[model samples]
Structure formats: structure tokens, C-alpha cells
Target: MTPTQIAALIVAGAFVLLVVLLAIPLVKLGRTLDEATVAIRKAHENTDPIFTGANSTLTHVNTQLERVDGITANAKTVSGNVSALSSLFTATLGGPLVKTAAFSYGVSKALRARRKRKEEPWGKHSRRKGGRK
Candidate 1:
């Protein structure tokens, strides 16, 4: 063969070898990109339900909080009514109760004084069982 034709053949072979080497990496890169795209699609699909569930949970929590607010309001109203009822009871029965208590105390004091006078007369002293005068 002529030297020039041989050099051209060598250059063509080198180029073909280089193209084959580059194509191997390019094919692997294409496969990696396809896998990444599929993973992204799967992530998107999974996250949709998570977001939906979170939204529904928030809605339910808000509803429960509203019920709690209503319960608190009712409790306040009941407390006010109870306070009013207590005041009414006091207003209706307080004076009579005080008067009755005072009358019983006076009667008990008079009975205790009368018993003491009967036990100890003013002109006499009693002897004890174990004593000397």
C-alpha cells in the first residue's frame, strides 16, 4: 500500500474506535436520565396523596376546634347561670337561716347556765373523793 493511503486508513480506524468509546458512555447516560424521569414521576404521584391527606386532616382539626369553641361558650353560660342560682339561693334563705341560728345559740347558752347554777350553789362547797380540806 502507499504510505499516504495507509495513514488515512489508520486515522479512520482511530475515529471509529473513539466513536465507539463515546457511544458507550452516551447510552449509559441516556438510561440514567430515563430512570431519573421515572423516579420523578413516581414521587409526584406519591406526594399527591400525602398533600390530600394533610388537607383533609387540617379540615377535620378545624372542625374539632370549632366544636371546642362552642363547648367553651356553653360552659361559660352555664357557669354564669350557676352563679346566678347561687345568688338567688342566698338571697332567698340567708336572713331566715341567720335568725334561726341566732335563736338556737341563745337557747343553748341559757340552758348551759342553768345547769351550772344547779351543780354549784353560791353558799356551799362540795368535798372530793380524794382530798383533804
Candidate 2:
């Protein structure tokens, strides 16, 4: 062969070697991508049941929350009723009750003072000698 022909053949052979080396990594990369796709499919299948269970759990939680809301409404109504009853009692009887208590305390004080004067019997003077008793 001519030198030019031999040089051309050498170049072609080197190009083929380079293509072969690149093809090996490309094939391995394709296999890795296929494995990743399979793993993703499996994860998707596994997550379906988990998502279903979570949905059911959320539904139940919402139901419980609704019940709690009803209870809170009832409690609020009862609280309002109690507050109104308290206001009514205060409006009706609170002043009179305070006046009665104060009157009773005054009566008690007056009675105690009368009893102490009766026990003393000399108007602030003791019966003992030199006022030491």
C-alpha cells in the first residue's frame, strides 16, 4: 500500500478504538438508568397504600375535629348561660346580701361591746388594787 493509504488506515483504526471505548460506558449508563426506573416504579407501588392509609387517617381526624367543634360550641353556650345567670343574681340580690352581711356584723360588734361593758361593771376601772389587773 502507499504511505498515505497506510496512514489513513491507521487513523481509521484509532477512530474505531475510540468508538468502542465510548460505547462501553454508554451501554453501562443505559443499564444504570433502567435500574433507576425500576426502583422508582417499585417505590411508587409501595407508596400507594401509604397514601391511602394517610387519607383515611386524615378523614378520621377531621371527623374527630368536627365532634370537638360541636362540644366547644356547647361549652360556649353553657358559659354564656352561666355568665347571664351570674349577672342576674348580682343584679337581683348582691347589694341586699352585702347590706345584710354588714348589718349582721354591726349587730355582732354592738352585742360584744355591751357584753364587755357588763363584765367590766365600773366603766373602764378594774376592781383590782392600783389598776394593775
Q: What is the C-alpha RMSD of each candidate to the true structure, in Å?
A: 5.8, 3.5
Candidate 1 per-residue lDDT, tens place, 19-97, comes to 9999999999999999999999999999989999999999999999999999999999999999999898889988888
How does each model score on lDDT? Answer: 0.90, 0.93
Model 1: how far residue 110 lies from native, Å: 2.8
Instruction: For candidate 1, give the lDDT of residue 99.
Output: 92
TM-score of 1: 0.57
TM-score, one value per model: 0.57, 0.88
Model 1, residue 73: C-alpha shift (Å): 1.5
Prediction 2 TM-score vs. true: 0.88
Segments in model 1 whose C-alpha atoms lie over 4 Å from true places: 1-37, 122-133
| Residue-level lDDT tens digits of model 2 in 19-133 | 9999999999999999999999999999999999999999999999999999999999999999999999999999999999999999999999889867876666445545434
Best by lDDT: 2
